[model samples]
Target chain A: MIAEGRIVIDLSRNGDVRLTSNRGADVARLLVGRDPREALDLLPRLFSLCGHAHVAAARVAVQEDVTEAEAHADTSRVLAETAREHLLRILTGWRVEGAGFELPSPPVMGLVKNMQAAVGDPAEERQVSALLAGYLETHVFGISPAAFLKLRDLAEFTNWLDGGPTLAKAYLCQIVAHGWQGLGAVSTQFLPALSGAQLQALMAEPSFTLRPEWHGQPHETGPLARQSRHPVVAALLELHGAGLMSRLVARLVDLAKIPTQMTTGESPVRGQPGVGVVETARGRLVHAARQEHGQLKDYQILAPTEWNFHPEGVAVQALAGLHAVTGRAEGAQALIEAIDPCVAFEVRAA
Target chain B: MCLAIPAEVVAITDDKQTATVSLEGVRKDISLALLTDVEPGDFVLIHVGYALNKISPDEAARTLALMAELEEVSS
Candidate 1:
């Protein structure tokens, strides 16, 4: 099997933090010179975490033309996948934060499996969205998605967090109790919406794929950046300034709105040397392909992990400022989770 | 960039909540918390110490061969 790389986070006693990743950026080179359709089919086998997103991006990148309906369907599938991903993270990953929090693994796993099973079938879009919304209502929010979305201020948010004992609530309450709401806050420049041509040009540079920066500045992406303008997240961001709380709440905001936000217009370049950009669970995922006579001459993928986990990127900047101590490891790990790398990670404190 | 390699389940624990999986002769135990109906000799995709799902053996073989090819290229 291809190497499933790991991220090593070392926290020193003097409050210094270093992040190292063995994640291979050259994995996409495997697609070079293959037929675009063949590469698209192979993507699911390659990327099991966000496999649907990868296939969707590669499909658009390789398509000579896209119909309105096809674009709408693709957008729907990606949204469903994103919601599934958020649910998995909230249910499974957050369970480690609270001693009393036990993951309801069976139902959560069942829901994710059902959602994944429907990913490639556009006819199952409505079913998938309904499944995700129902799971959120029963397992996560303990309220309807609509009601949760209407929560506009920090008071309402805290009231909701205090009311539930689910994994999401337990972990969030700890964040509040520890006063880690503002932990990891930093000056933020969100990645902006770019046209296909603009994105293609930027992605052509080799350094851009491994250590991407927009206009010489490290910009943040993913649910927090995408949903920062939402009323609930905006209220949190206004209070906390894009810290752990704001980031986690933004993921909820994004997941709650997925059923209603399926009409995103993806403007992929139409022919050879095509480029497709998609918003995934972690952040923006870009795929570029250059084909001659129906075979790819060049292929490249720029995943969100690279941008958020860049040597001088958002994750490092947030972790660097903290005073490394015994009790701070939990917050540091939570911060990394809020930033959300696609690979496995280890937190080593010394 | 989110590539997840599949591993072969060589043995199941007595409690049935975990399994020992093998990949290219390397062995490690993984939780079966996210999946059910897994058996020895099944190929499963793993992430963060959990087995995400089971895959067909043919698909498993194809992926392993491709991964070997990737190792050669990167090496």
Candidate 2:
């Protein structure tokens, strides 16, 4: 019978996991395996949020000696599903965490009312129910131009009984125009303006951006969760605007972009060492891995939360930026929230 | 890293194990596991689905306030 192998690991923010094996196994032997099933089970758990990434890496490490075509398609499907799940969690967070003000709106209030009713919170139920009615009334008369405009053309239509058609139509036009402008900004001003290759290169290096002091210092992550969606320095200079609202708007816009991408053939690349890097509502997230021999090996994930929530160094920069602009405790908290640091994923191991 | 952070309890359940805490504009559920007899508005260190310790709200406020004050002085 084959002896049981054990590998213990400690992880650093830079996607490096230190592994110590106690079964007289080299990297190759540990990865390739005598009993492939049992050997694969010994890999260390890395970040919980990026379990798919870790598994993919393991597959790569094992397949180093094999052909790429041998990689399992089922595994690729699982990884993509994991990525989708992660994205959904982020979107839910955006609605609940990033856009609390919008909650008072009718459509949102309806959802909240249902949730409260189901949860059996009488006071909350009353509050949400009342809010939902008020939202409907205001939306009908076009009193809330922004709210009316935001929902006018959506499939889930709400009849605002008091809203004037003329006003609602005008507001809708304005909202659509604003949305287009936001998209243009994202495509031309924001994304295209930055050199992807250069940014990726910067990521590969060790720097204060990733390793900052101050234990559990808050940083942001998520699709629309933070200012990371906007090029902070560039936005300050060009847009001359920086705050919670601006950051939230950017994320909502990003949400509008995702469904199309998901519907198209833009999912995570399977089997090969494909990395999905994005500036989430927080700062930045990188998912990279290698798949080999129908198993996962050598996975690495760098999440925005890791950079922002570092115990020491990089957090100072984020804090300094927030302090410079808002200069208040609430403002600092807002900035921290703007980063939306995901501590859950940071400390989790799969 | 998942985007979770430590927050102060603005209110607590009778049992003191669950609490309402605020982070940014959002408020959510937090478990009080690491500290004893936590009260309203006491800061706690939170990470990955758990509150690890009780942090002083005064300290958090002071640190943030100081950052703001320093930024003003510099600007």
Candidate 3:
């Protein structure tokens, strides 16, 4: 296994969200000057949480495409991994805070099989939907998928939080209990859709693959960015901005969309200058490769963590001027986890 | 793709999604959101915050021994 990367965050008396990591260096070492095939093979080994999405991004980055069946398979696999990642975060978050929760993995592989069957037959498709609805109701939202999907405003979301038995409600309660409402506030600086030329310019830096920037400013990628288009997300944006709660809720809610994406998402293939923009469970991931003479001439990967946790980026911006309702130490840790670095992190109060 | 370790579930919550797990007095909350069947006292392989699989005590010991051996070789 690729050793999990480390992040060191320092919360100073002045309330600075000072964060640092060497994960980019690890990625650069693995990718730069390496064969595309080897790097693609290593993607899953390195990124265990959402390996399928990493693989898909690499395939897209290499100007590769899969048939419709393969594309559906890839999407379904990634969706399964994403749901697992979200559940893990929730389970881990609750437990670390002293919740006595059990550990039981969802039937990820089985869901993929069922989703495949659903792709061809309506009956199996309904079965898949009903199955997901049951699981999400019991674990995620405490409401039917239809009701959860019907929530289009903060009022509805608030009602759901007030009475819903879902993990989303529990997570919201945690944030509010910690007095983190409007805490760790980040601007909605979505990474703009890029042209091939722009992508080339962004990837020109030696550190681009691990820590990409647009116009020299850091942005966010991941569930929050991907689901910013949803009605509930839009309401949250208007009401709460992108805080810790908003980010976490967006993550859980994204589970509702994965099945649909699997059945209707675009082909996971692109041609030339292969710049693949994929949304992993954590955030947006980009993999681009340039091939010449039947060999990889250049390759780069941009992970969501790189953008959100950048030294002077979203994490710092969110933590700036944090009031620290609890203690600086606890508040800082909460804020960091709110930004949710894909890798493990260490917190220090100085 | 990753490694998980055997842990004992000491307590379970009302929601059944979170539980307290222990490994030698150290405790953690493991998410049960993924599995259809699990309970406190179950021994499971833990990774991140999710319980990966159930294991027998003997099997857990054997896996740990192999892991320790691999660490030694790597070192």
Q: What is the TM-score of chain B alone in each candidate?
A: 0.92, 0.66, 0.74
Q: For residues A1-350, what per-residue lDDT tens digits would candidate 1 score against the true structure?
A: 45677889998888777889888536677888888878977888787787777877887888776666666556665666677678778866675442665545665555545645665565565576666667678777888787889997878887898885766777777877788888988878889887788888887887788778889977888999888888879988888887889998898887788765642323321223388777888999988888899889888888898889887888888887667433678878889988999988998977
Sort order, DockQ high to low: 1, 3, 2
lDDT per model vs. reference: 0.78, 0.37, 0.65
Candidate 1 chain A: worst-modelled 10 consecutive residues by lDDT: A263-272
Give, for candidate 3 chain A, the lowest lDDT window spanning 10 residues.
Answer: A263-272
Which candidate ranks first by TM-score, i.e. highest? 1
The per-residue C-alpha lDDT of model 2 at residue A17 equals 32
Pick by DockQ: 2 or 3, better one: 3
Q: If you score just chain A, what TM-score does every candidate get?
A: 0.89, 0.39, 0.85
Instruction: Please state the CAPRI-style docking class of candidate 3.
Output: incorrect
lDDT of 2 by residue, B1-75 (tens): 321124667888888878787764468787664346678878764543445445566655643443333334334
Give candidates' CA RMSD values in order: 2.8, 16.7, 6.2
Candidate 1 pairs with clashing backbones = none
What are the per-residue Cα lDDT tens digits for candidate 2 across A1-87? 111122233333443333332321112223321333433343322122333333444444333443433232313322233323333
